[model samples]
Target: MFIRNERSIKEFIRYYPVVSTIIIIHILTWLLDIIPIGLFNQLYHLGVGSHWGLQNGEYWRFITPIFLHGGLTHMLFNSFSLVLFGPALEEMLGKAKFLFAYIGAGVLANIATFIIHPSILYSHVGASGAIFGLFGVYVFMVAFRKNLIDSQSSQIVMVIFIIGIIMTFLRPNINIYAHILGFVVGFLIAPLVLNGARPYYPPQYRKSYDDDGEIRFDPNRWKKKRFSRKTKQNFLWTIIIILVVIGVLYNVF
Candidate 1:
């Protein structure tokens, strides 16, 4: 199990430069902090959270916070999660969609944080929000396409999600809302990003169990609906509906 995933991660990163660049940028930011260079340090501070980052016309901060970290430990933990889950997701969704989902989730997480806690005047930094976004994609994909993974893998994935959510509450000074909102955005937008990217069951696995729970493998009994381009278009329509509803609510007096 681990071996296959490891091989896939390597292949995914080798073929895709976006994930590698993100990881490198995060590491470089950490290194920059330790080196204490004047100009590099000055640019590094751009990622540190600011309440008016969006309002002050420094819109980059919306996405930059996902690369910044509070400390070495913070960076390490986030880096671990990123490499563990980010690559496969990028492979599944394709680079452009994956990048959009990540940045979009982080931006919404930050936006939600501000709306929910307007008085909390502290600089936020960390990739946990974006990491949780990847986690969210994993969860949604698992829910939609259970045949893609085994039962054991699904159990581990659920346990990780449960433990991760619990940790957000147990740890102080952590923005639980950001993680939650990131997850929500990831869950909602993943279907649209997937957009016909789901893996289909093979011909041989189309078998059914007997009344006493006996196993059989038949190659001809095909019953599942085809996940075609029309299905992808329906998901895109759902995304549009959701966005239109949210926009109306936000702007309506």
Candidate 2:
């Protein structure tokens, strides 16, 4: 379920519009921030998760920071995480429910951050909270709703989740409160939205065979071979390793 089968960016977007749109927004806002025109400086000042802003009734800060990032590395890391993880949930929960869960987790995480850090100057940004929320949903599926994911994917989720939790504590400037609370919120909200949810199967790889008495006729043949389960597992593990290296580098620099 964690494997991505899309051959191109267009196909990826077509299959997973919600994840695509969120990533697009991340890139756009990040571009705005770095454009050197100072046009979006107000966005940085107003949209960051500032306890001061929340106290003064700028409630949108909760939602806005989910789409904002502090730098290229910040945006790319979260976007890569989403690209790797978000499609399965989007496919399982449907677009609307997936959006609800994502935004809900992020907003609640920001609220938790505000409550946990009472100082007026405390502020945070990035979608790490929301990304952790995605991990939370996977954790719920892996633990309570086993049928929703396969054994391999569950192992991947648990490994990544554990690594993520460790990194949350190890990384400097990390918003521990947002990450933890977002995960909790996602775990709690999973049952409400996951009714009738099923494991993800990419449309392109779906095939059916028609039985003609003793022989089966395969009607849907593709020029390219589909990925083996082992191949996908290896690829995912490679990504996990790369993420670990990146996380370590992030801590160093």
Candidate 3:
């Protein structure tokens, strides 16, 4: 299920460093193609299928392929989805758990891809499989607990999935099989990850009290009051600077 309230961008960035790092890697890979050192090329080669499958000695290709993307569009779209879904999942599950889920899902997705298309030697890349896993977790978390996912957010996810399906049919080069397989695997595995996890409490549900043992009914009093305006402004500017740095790195090597 999706978050009920809009998370502040700052809060999101703070909780999702792994997501941000992966996106940065995608952008850097694209920008580094302009360099002549062949570093990006080397990484690309290392990340591809590499004659590795269920039969090959290099079985790691099942997982490594998720970190590689064929082109700028592939990288951008996958990274965008990661950013959209990563933070919420990370917030719900701790960073370490989220990371495990992502990598595990990626590996499973790659294995499925290899099993179905063993003879095809195309270099596979992008975070779609992992994103699919995140979607799987989201759907599972919500479906099992209807209160977790609000109606609006559920509709949004459905719309996105529909769009993805349409794009799969329209785009000849798109790997619809991989996407479907990844999604299925992710959905199947999410419940296991969430087993024994406690239900999340919305911020609104948490109440504060006064020294007199009276419940503080004023909503404004519940708002975070520690930070001064100047402090908040400085933090906002800092976030802006960080975002700018990420954008620059995305565009240039």
Number of the top lDDT candidate = 2
Tens-digit lDDT track for model 2 on 1-253? 6767789999999989999999999998888788777657766667788888889999999899999998888898899899999998998899999999899999999988888797998888999888888888889998899988988889888988899999999888889999999999999999987986877767677555463434222355334556765776789899789989988887787
Q: TM-score rank, highest first?
A: 2, 1, 3
All candidates' TM-scores?
Answer: 0.72, 0.91, 0.71
| Alpha carbon lDDT at 33, candidate 1 | 71
lDDT of 3 by residue, 103-193 (tens): 8887887777776776646546667777777777777766775555666556566656655655556555556656777777778877776
Q: Which stretches of candidate 3 lie over 4 Å from their true place?
A: 1-11, 52-55, 196-218, 221-253
lDDT (Cα, tens digit) per residue for candidate 1, span 119-238: 645568888788788777778878986654555446556766776786677667888988999999888887888775634233223454544633344655333334555664565445
Worst 10 residues of 1 by lDDT: 1-10
TM-score of 1: 0.72
Question: Cα lDDT of all candidates, in order?
Answer: 0.68, 0.86, 0.64
Which scores better on lDDT, 1 or 2? 2
lDDT of 2: 0.86
Preferred candidate (TM-score higher): 1 or 3: 1
Model 1 pairs in collision: none
